[model samples]
Target: MHPSFTQRVTALEGLRARTRQATAEFYQKPGVMPPPLAPLIIVRSSGNNTFSLINRATGEVIAERFGHNNATSHARELEADIKRFNVKQFGRHLRDWALRISAILFLFAFFGSHA
Candidate 1:
């Protein structure tokens, strides 16, 4: 029999903790380096009629809805929420890029004048 979603997620969370510990140990070893950890996104859909958006890092339930009848409306709301989140994330990235570019330009203007 297939494991339930909650059970699978619980197992994965245990593995994630172990991986994090191993990563910490690897960093402590002499001259050992690994690539940065990538973000994790887990998506699941079931006919059981429940919806949830969770933040894996913080273990927070950002949003959730229950009931089969409201599924369509819930899905639409979730889609809009995702769109808003994406736009906010995009804005943050743009702001960060602008800051980096400004810093580089400032450095060039400051150092170039001295050279």
Candidate 2:
């Protein structure tokens, strides 16, 4: 996965660490310049083989890579797309108030519970 979240196999701290690492690495990737993104959200499309990194608080899609693999090279194609990409990142709306902190913590908690 793009984030390598390890949701079912690791602890909350692990997920946090991986998420941070992934975010850092993502920013470090050659030519992947992000713009004022906060509380980034990584999404794996349920109905398709698309993986995306977004700014949930702003409904902005910073990057996207298609395929069952999140590490695919398809991510390189989003330079121009990233500049114009914008959309809702409010999740499923099942939790209308999934504030950034809560949402990130919930990702860890939800995975911890499953593990």
Per lDDT, the best of the predicted structures is 1
Candidate 2 lDDT over 1-115, as tens digits, reads 5455666446787888999999998999999987764323545463567676555667676667676466234433343355453555435353566676698898999999999
Candidate 1 yields a Cα-based lDDT of 0.69
**How well does candidate 2 score on lDDT at residue 110?**
98
What is the model-wide C-alpha lDDT for candidate 2?
A: 0.62
- Candidate 2's TM-score: 0.23
Against the reference, the lDDT scores of all candidates come to 0.69, 0.62
Off by over 4 Å in 1: 1-85
Query: Candidate 2: where are CA atoms >4 Å away?
Result: 1-10, 37-115
List model 1 lDDT by residue over 1-115, tens digit each. 4569889999999999999999889889989887855433223344467766555566665556566445446555655665575877989999999999999999999999999
Instruction: Quote the RMSD, in angstroms, for model 1.
Output: 11.9
